[model samples]
Target: MEAKLYDGPMIDAHQHFWQPQINPHPWLAPDVLIPFRYGDYSAIKREYLPPDYLKDATPKHNVVATVYVDAEWDPKDPMGETKYIHTVAEKYGMPNAVVAQAWLHADDVEAVLKAQSQYPLVRSVRHKPAGALSPAEAQSGIRTLMSDEKWRQGYALLAKFGLNFDLQTPWWNLHEAKRLALDFPDTLIILNHTGLPYDRSAEGLKEWHKAMSLLSDIPNIVVKISGIGLPDKKWDINDNRWIVQETVQIFGTDRAMFASNFPVDSLCGDLETIFTGFKEAVKDYSPEDQHKLFFANAKKYYKMKI
Candidate 1:
């Protein structure tokens, strides 16, 4: 019998806290005049900060703790996103965990890794999703960057820095991800959102599923079953359970885990609804597997000491 899952020993492997007003969030590309405003739910309202990150996110997901992902504090900034996250994670003593952005140009990789030297909570780095482009196209771009010799050199540095790479990309980018995995087998690589694609009517879902299966072939890469307010349709996590469950079928329990991608995902549902939806989505799995999806996997991936 499958045991019930009650938000087990959970450390939210993914969650963001940013405030355009109070904190640094310059990448919030808004569409105020659209059918509905999009990009960065934090823009619609102040989010990902003390009251929300500490008070709401903690209780809502039944989160025993959280891994603070870098909010991409503008790629152009000299300070870089790592320091910003380091400051906040240190300020709140959040989750005793953190994931900062390395966002290297595939060339300045060493400088990027060395930049985060002091921040102990800085556990990982996110290379933002090249979602708009197809995997092949992105591969061309990434390879162009990697072929620079210096870029290939960067991969070694990231692996050396003891950092994890959270690929915040879409389904189309999976192939390139696999390439990265082959090149750096020792580095922990995570796929955020089961590889988001243009999913309105399962148009590319079958293809995406195949891509995910291929991605799982790389032992070091894990999948994050989270993302929201993305194009193709569902409004909230509750409405999106089918897709999440489908993703689990492809990635399986050991390779996949739950993440709230909060504030960003807040565009769809509050933390309660998010957790409720996730619980519903995975409730049918075995207790041990369920534990891995909701918590254990994240603890291991990000090396969260929680």
Candidate 2:
């Protein structure tokens, strides 16, 4: 059955806007080529400000508001990204919320968290915690895992500042995530990219499913169902439907949200293709549940003032 298009207001739970020319994003630098999920991201290395994003989203989707996730800005000046986003929001009237950057284990973590909390638009912070490369490597336990005392020391500070954490680790490290959530029950942990289920093999999916199920048992954690695109493939519904549906099934409608992960995700497909695929994937659900998945959950999770 073809899913009807949703015309309701949406709060993009996760997306980014960057001006690499003005503010330095090392990853987006001309010389720096990091291993990316979407292969050659050269197509998106240019300045993608609010106007660029709205051109891709508006008229196609009713995008009432958006939450700006931090693009890796120059770490030497962590607060620079948040300040720039505030200016964009003031000028553009979108990105009603901001997920600023913070290095959880950095020497200046405490000062950074305190400063980030001061911004009215800042609601959450993302510090992609260090994790193992593969399940085999994870078995021995990496020192920088969320379990690390120094990292936990920094993570524990989130509650004090009334901030949430946006976690972007692979599915294999969710066991570590579960423990972190249990220990710090007060801090709301928003899992990015559906726990990053990149490996699509039968065995890979089984592992991903097991990891997702394990993490779902924790009440403090929620998930954003975005960034499921593969390197060399187009963003087709057939390839991503199961991952989206299974995530909502595991985390429940209230705990899972749909996001664009745009500019970066644009490397795979257009915004219309991604959001339409999301609407179609869960069209079997009731309207209320659909609304929660696409809109309400994001607003609530990010404390978006929409």
Candidate 3:
């Protein structure tokens, strides 16, 4: 029951591209390593571009188009990643869509959003707000910054540019996320990594399920089913299957799509193994439903022409 056969071309709705060599990602720097929430992420500290991504994604999963989610790069040059992905998209014909980053609280937020919006492939923006509930979580260097007026002002700019939002935050904050979704009814909100149910305990998962259910009630919100192993870096098909099935059940095929999360998930297993687990998890669904989860939904959600 945990594994099922699924063969479909995927439109990877979520993934990332970063060149640590030319651009500085302080988190990815080798010597200054710290414990990340995802646990022992040192394995992915090197440069990863479309070529490397294609090498890992193709001949196995049949990734026709992928959407590049923002990788935390040097904060000083927020548009750098967009420029880099443009080159990759032009050369490889992959990453047909890009979700660039812009600090929602910055004084020049509009200027940044405008610059990012000018890029043809950019369809959304990702500026993960920090809203940790516990002192430990706060000390972990994660922020809980959603309610700020300045940030909301910046969030308002997305509608002006006609860009959607890629939201990556802890699950505890989904209630606030729901409010934001309501406030901007016209703006599309894509929730990253299955609400990031970082806690795998029975109680933790139960809490995660509750939060996701509440967020799913909002028509503007869509869930990206990936990062099942994030809270704990171990992988199990059955556990992942339950998360995948529960997400699709709650949001339905039209509102849910699968993403590789690639190098981040590469910490758990190879690309084939990761996507195979996803395919197997949804094997009982109809071919059309599987196509929606694996391909069509991403194309629609990301607004990718390919």
The top-ranked prediction according to TM-score is 2
**Number of clashing residue pairs, candidate 2:** 0
The Cα error of candidate 1 at residue 16, in Å, is: 1.2
Per-residue CA lDDT of model 1 for 108-181, tens digit only, reads 65776777644677777775643345546655665333334554566567777888777766666666678878
Off by over 4 Å in 2: 1-3
Give the range where candidate 3 is weakest over 10 consecutive residues by summed lDDT.
Answer: 134-143
Q: If scored against the real structure, what TM-score would every candidate get?
A: 0.83, 0.97, 0.92
| lDDT for 156 (candidate 1) | 62
* lDDT leaderboard ranking: 2, 3, 1
- The top-ranked prediction according to lDDT is 2
Clash number for every model? Answer: 1, 0, 5
- Single out the weakest 10-residue window by summed lDDT for candidate 1: 31-40
lDDT of 2 by residue, 1-306 (tens): 445656688888889988777778989988778988788888888888888888998797988899999999998898988898999999999789999999888889999999999998999999988769887888786634497888889999999999999999998899888999999999999999998998999999999999999977788999999999988888999999999999999999889999999889999999989998998898888878889988899988888877
Each model's C-alpha lDDT?
0.68, 0.90, 0.84
**TM-score of candidate 2 on Cα atoms, chains taken together:** 0.97
